[model samples]
Target: MSMIQTNDFDHVNLIEKVIENNYMTYFNYDEFTNKLEFENSISSANWNIIQNNLLINITDSENIENIIDKLIDHLIKLHDEFGYGFAGVKQIIEQNIQYINQPLLNNILDWLIKNQISSKYIFFHGFLYFNGII
Candidate 1:
């Protein structure tokens, strides 16, 4: 599919492609999204946590600011309460698995920052440097 249309970014379609490609992007979006979906299928609570905490809806009228801030707040709270960072997030995602997807963790941070989810990371210094969200 086309990457752009009408001089604007097609985020929804981009996300779909990212998931579909599932190659060596910032973190295998396909794997993670599918894993999350599967995990949710088994337990509504798990799904709800992810859906409510980190989920983003691509639409013209969406108030992304609120969701972004909420997600950052969630991460910050986790850090403040449990000292969680990439490791903690990885642990949550992988669950019983031995290995952790570092890229996925990085992507989460990148997503938060790139989307203005966190005001502190709002600067666009690494527009091309980042692998995930760009």
Candidate 2:
């Protein structure tokens, strides 16, 4: 009888593979403005790339919920460390939401609400305040 073979991989390896396979675009913050600008144009290819990459990375992790929780922690840390203005915070949250699952987004929203941070402030006022950044 013939037997099928299987392969085993770790979370880090999975994340690397996911990133390599997807997320064709990369960006860095502008030194002068401290703003994140996409290096590539916004297109279907780019959107699919990013979405697939994030999905794979999160799915491969041991605990997806933990990954999202850690991401929130990092966001809080960034806010504390860099004193990210409301606009910056909003942008970060929006970007994260776009990449993460709905449940994770809901958790983030709930956390922000519990902290007395209004979603409206982050959505509307935040964009208006940082129009120049975009």
List CA RMSD, all candidates.
16.9, 18.4
Candidate 2: which stretches are off by over 4 Å? 1-64, 101-134
Candidate 2 lDDT by residue in tens digits, 1-134: 99977554343455456457863223332222322233342111212112222222344333544554455554566467745545455556455546666675555445444544555435433343355322
Top candidate by TM-score: 2
Error of 1 at 31 (Å): 22
Q: Kindly list the per-residue Cα lDDT of model 1 for residues 40-59, writing each as its tens digit.
A: 23111111123233422323
Clashing pairs in 2: none
* lDDT of the candidates, in the order given: 0.39, 0.44
Clash pairs, model 1 backbone: none
As a whole number from 0 to 100, the lDDT of residue 110 in candidate 1 is 57
How many clashes (backbone atoms < 3 Å, residues ≥3 apart in a chain or on different chains) does model 2 have?
0
Residue 87 accuracy (lDDT) in model 1: 43
